[model samples]
Target: MLWFPTLSKSGFRSFIADNDEGSTGKWMVPIPVPDIGLIWEEIEDAAVEGRILAAKKSTHELVRIIGHNLACVYCSASDPDTVAETLRTLREIGVDGELKYKSDLATFDGREEYLYSSSEFETLLPRP
Candidate 1:
């Protein structure tokens, strides 16, 4: 499962994608926006199970889960400390991966917009 974070009027939004073949046969699942604690709990759980592929923040930060090649894009506005803490936890749990920032902010204004990140980070997502 992959968790993609985005922002909404209510709060943070996480869209989960079950990538297993024949599992629900859906591309993504929209889950209820939980508080930061719950979000981290979920991440920890996924990490323990070794099922997380990637995680993204709405602030344009992306975390790619090593080996799995899963890319998670976070789209919610978050404080630096929160971001740092999350990354630290991931690292402590042995979820090795690189953190990437969006390269072109202007290109992310709409759903049709293609996501482009810095050269340091590679994305499985295609460029528009």
Candidate 2:
């Protein structure tokens, strides 16, 4: 299955460096957006129901990607203890104002930090 390159080449290079252990296979493979789009349905599971609205931090001068992908929201939900909770969880995750977070380097720091960095004895300052 194809996945979007959500980071820049150099950015992705760094991502590969930092994430080498978690993944395996070719370290670098660049594909154009149109080419990647060819396998959209397979990667995102497009076709069962509602479309997929991806909120990834874009690369290649793009923003969020909307695909025809659909999944059993029940299957993808994190805390799917009950039918109703599972159904409503992701269905309204975007509009409900419920914030879920993951531990990534950038998220740990403010957005401003990701754009610039300084290593003057381990202190990072704002670039304003």
Please, what is the whole-model Cα lDDT of each candidate in the order they appear? 0.32, 0.25
Alpha-carbon lDDT of model 1: 0.32
Task: Mark the regions of model 2 whose C-alpha exceeds 4 Å error after superposition.
Answer: 1-31, 46-102, 110-128
What is the C-alpha local distance difference test score of candidate 2?
Answer: 0.25
State TM-scores per candidate.
0.31, 0.20
Clashes of each: 9, 1
Q: Write the per-residue lDDT of candidate 2 for residues 1-128, one digit (tens) a residue.
A: 22343322122221212331221111011223454443323322322232321222224333224332212111111111222232233333321222222213333233222211112211222222
Question: How would you encode candidate 1's per-residue C-alpha lDDT over 1-128 as one tens digit per residue?
Answer: 33344322334333322221111111111222333334445553643454433343322121233322233423322233333343444444433434443212222322333222133222322333
For residue 54, give model 2's deviation from the true position in Å: 7.8
